[model samples]
Target: MEHIPHGSPDDPNPLRRLSLEQLRRRTSIKWRAYPEDVLPLWVAEMDVPLAGPVARAVTDAVALGDTGYPAGTGYAEALASFASERWGWDTLAVERTRLVSDVMTGVVEVLKLITSPGDAVVVNCPVYQPFYLFVEHMGRRIVEAPLDERARIDPGGLEDAFRRAVRGGHRAVYLLCSPHNPTGTVHTTGELAAVAALAARHGVRVVADEIHAPVVSRSARFVPYLSVAGAESGFSLMSASKAWNLAGLKAALVTAGPAAAGDLARMPPEVGHGPSHLGVIAHTAAYRDGGDWLDALLGGLDENRSLLAALLAEHLPGVRHLPGEGTYLAWLDFRALGLGDDPAAVLLERGRVALHPGPPCGTGGAGHARLNLATSPGILTEAVRRMAAAL
Candidate 1:
């Protein structure tokens, strides 16, 4: 790497090369269907290398051969410390913090521990999808409370859902997502507080999935459920895995109120004993020293965001997207394209770009597509180009 003078990177042609191409050339996986050169905008991992701190930690842990059956361990301490340092909130002590195979497992286990069959669990549509499956798989009835057009959470709608559930003699549980998955809407503290009040009134249990809390946008504020006034009486699901792009490492933290945590703790030893030991090393590394890399990565994302907006307008004018306030995911409206109401199939298969269709995200996501901007700028540009050509 040569020392290039630090100057305006906004010049149409920036100094040096983009890491996006490096990742693309390195990726041996065939993303698009045969015969199609794929430009994958799917999966949550960043195309760039892991943060130096996290990288060093993972490497050192590997050197130490820390892999083992991470049943009862220091993993909790690592997660709690991370929470205290980053979020400024004292998460339940490590002893109180339970581990799971990963985030999806935590969400599933939490839902089952509280709600019963036929009970109403409130979910904002176009959710992470696993929530719906978790509820349905657990035999709980789903209370559909969809997000508004802006992708911002609708507290009033949520309260209405809670009110309706209580009246129907159905137990209500809230599956919350902040700095949401596909749409990337970071729920405001006030909105979350309003929802919390409504749920408390209806005796609803709130299971907040805040995995994306760490990558918050510069102008946005992402408040963890437990950080909210009523969160001590709530459930918070978070982990360092998402923030560090270590999802494959497999570990997440689940904390809830006393009674709830105790009840949750006893369900099965398997629930808490499922986290990966490697993930623990990565978690600690990321929380303790990855801030610098994260900031630089965010800067890259900001540029990519601007590039995406400009590129879409100039080339793929048919595709519409909200400058994602937070999260690497970008939600695009593709209805304007001649591809009719939805263009994911046409884009992914015909256009050779893998885009998560919006309908699966829920009603608000309909006629929409979710693009992961976590990759390199060049890759994003190519993705947009391919999508434009397909349209």
Candidate 2:
């Protein structure tokens, strides 16, 4: 197969290049969840065509009838290469990595290995909604360490939660969302190092969800949790799905730090059976050959971030948008609009625009809405206009 040229950063913004009609044709939940009249800027899914390498890799496999159970460590090796070249982290040992169904599934399985049922799991509040749902569903208790007023990790608050979580000699795990969702705050190295120290002191195991690691803009750096000085016992879950827009292809890696390799080794053999063979192929292709495409996408997301801030300031003056350094998600505070806890509900009902409500994101999320900014600029403009109209 001929290699696809990785587009330059100066290329036209991919997000602005797609049409609404083209996006509506997608069968994914992002488009199908809402009626035609309603604009959906809710889900994490991006509105762009598949990267050439990923599309070809999957399509070529289907053409050859290569569908079967996943095998080999190609995915792990590819990720190791990507990590080394991208972040200068040359310590990613492929032997410490295990393939699983997706990031959340990997998180659950890793937590199971480290903590039993009824154990406590700590999380930063106003985080990704699934962190709450998945942890609770796994029969674990959730303790909240709410982010400080600036939406950055509060060392004191985290220490308090860690201290509380391990008070009874109970096992606890701190579920971290790096390059955090909704808020889009890219955790600094100093911030992550502090978290490692706190977790170490409290005997709390850290499991970082780094699915959005590759989506960071040029302005911010994504610090892998396990790379911190005191985090040799931590675990990290990563995948190419989010960056490549391949969520339907369910495959992810659970990487263990040097101290946690034994725990990862103890994960049930059958757990590896969950990932689709095709998903593995697609993800492997993404990590190995999708770098150029990823750079191009990041450029588009950066533009959208600026566009969103300008639009909100001009159209919905009451809305406060703190643009994130990573991910295409925009966490907008609508409390000034006097819309109560869930302004998203009102936006959907009155404005025919859909957004993920802030309350569901946990404490500090009230009166805020999470908007997906991975769409065409036109859609974003219209969504804001409708939101203003509703207000």
Per-model TM-score, in order, reads: 0.88, 0.96
Pick out the ten consecutive residues of candidate 2 with the lowest summed lDDT. Answer: 1-10
**Model number with the top TM-score:** 2
Against the true structure, candidate 1 reaches a TM-score of: 0.88
Indicate the residue-level lDDT of 337 in model 2.
81
How far off is residue 355 in model 1, in Å? 0.5
Give lDDT tens digits, candidate 1, residues 129-218. 677766678887777787887777777788888887766676677888877877778877788788777777779888888888887777
**Which regions of candidate 2 deviate over 4 angstroms?**
1-12
Model 1: which ten-residue window has the lowest total lDDT? Answer: 1-10
Q: What is the Å distance of residue 53 in model 2 from its true position?
A: 0.4
Give the lDDT of residue 88 in candidate 1. 73
**Clash pairs detected, candidate 2:** none
1-391: candidate 2 lDDT, tens digit per residue: 1121233334455665566767779999999999989989999999888887999999999999999999999999999999988988889999999999999999999988999888999999899999999999999999999998888999999999999998888999999999899899999989999999999988999999999999999998888888889999999999998999989999999999999999999999999999999999999999999888888788878877888888888889888877889888999999988899999999999999999999989999899999998887678778888888788
